[model samples]
Target: MKTEIRFTHQSLVENSKSGDRTAQYQLYELYVDAMYNVSMRFLGVKEDAEDIVQESFVDAFRNLDKFKYESSFGAWLKRIVINKSINHLKVKRLPLAAMDDNEYHLTNEDEHEYQNIDAMDIMKVKSGIEKLPYGYKQIINLYLLEGFDHNEISDVLGITTSTSKSQYHRAKKKLVEIINTL
Candidate 1:
């Protein structure tokens, strides 16, 4: 089922790359909702998410020629959307702090603290994440929800890998605290 969908999506992308207007519209329709949700997760504002999604689609179509099939087109488009969202956040002056590598250490107990987080209600967890400070929320969203590893996150957010790890840990701890309060 998934492979067939990918093949159809690939065909649509190829047509879009060739400047086929109908195919481009179809491709936009296919991805817009998911991309909007992703943008919403990052921005937490409907207006911002809507604007970013529109901008991201325009940018994706304009740059479609540069895309290779190395990864799925959706994944490629998603990267563009995420980057745009992050750029938007940066423009808002959201301070993503860099941590000194020697300042904090990760331990087994810290890992254990997060292990049971999955048992919480999804909506509750999401609410907890939303209450986090901007930097922690971004790290939690990128790592836990978007599945970006620390290295990729560091690259995207212009921080060190150690900072990413430390932030993620702090985010988790904060999220747990938030959940407990609720």
Candidate 2:
């Protein structure tokens, strides 16, 4: 079933690449909301998210020919959107700090301590996330909300893997503190 859906999506993408306006629109309709959500996760501002989504789609269409089938079209498009979002943040001078290797290390024991956060109120957690500093917020959103692992986060943000892991651990701690205060 999943393979069939992917083939259908790929066909639409191929048609769009061939300049079929209806196929392009279909692809847009299929992915706009998800892409919009991805933009919103990186950018809290509605206007910024909307602008990035538009820009991402335009860029995606323009470069459709360069897209190879190594990954799903959605995955390919997501990479484009994420890169655009990060670039937008860079333009705004959002500073993501690099951490020393020895600054923070998470043991399995420490991981167990934070598992209780899963039971916290969703609204409260989201509010806490929004209240975080820009750098911390981005790391948290990429790792926790967007399902990117530390290596992937490092690549996306142009930080080292160690920095990504350190930032994520610190961000999780800070988020807990924020949620506790609320």
Candidate 3:
């Protein structure tokens, strides 16, 4: 049963892995838009997102044989897109050394407030996320929207787990403020 779930779009993937043009084209058509959106959420630039999505598809197809189906094809492709987008950001961004490390932990009162926010509007949150600075935006996109835990975000961003945890809390606080004004 686990294998069955992992083998989503198996036939198309297998055919594409074997260099079947039609199968590859079908997979491209099925995933392109979703991949573009994922890239856009991180890159925040239309041209960069489009280029990254295109490169992701190319890399995915080129490395198709290496895909073992441990994850769904879409998930695998999304990872490539995310990695490329993050790398793109890293190239253009600076290190976060200016912030104090002690502010990493959230207090009980902050946690309670964070939990009680009445943010039922997805569009407002999305817009607020878009307005966030690059550092906060990356943390919010990775932790909240992508459902990544601190460990996974740390691994992806090459930061410590504690740093990831702190950054996410800080980013969420900023997001809440932005959402309120929206």
Q: Give, for candidate 3, the lowest lDDT window spanning 10 residues.
A: 1-10
Error of 2 at 12 (Å): 1.1
Q: Which stretches of candidate 3 lie over 4 Å from their true place?
A: 1-8, 94-100
Q: In model 1, where do residues sit more than 4 Å from their true spots? A: 1-7
Per-prediction CA RMSD (Å): 3.8, 4.3, 5.2
Q: Write the per-residue lDDT of candidate 2 for residues 49-98, one digit (tens) a residue.
A: 98998898889999999988999889989888888998999999987765
Model 3, span 12-126: residue lDDT tens: 9998888988788889988999999999999888999999999999999999988998999999999999989999998987343346657667888888877745545878878
Q: Best-fitting candidate, measured by TM-score?
A: 1
- Indicate the TM-score of model 3: 0.89
- Please give each candidate's TM-score: 0.93, 0.90, 0.89
lDDT values for all models: 0.88, 0.88, 0.85
lDDT of 1 by residue, 46-86 (tens): 99999999999999899988898888888988998899999
- Descending-lDDT candidate ranking: 1, 2, 3
- Model 3, clash count? 0
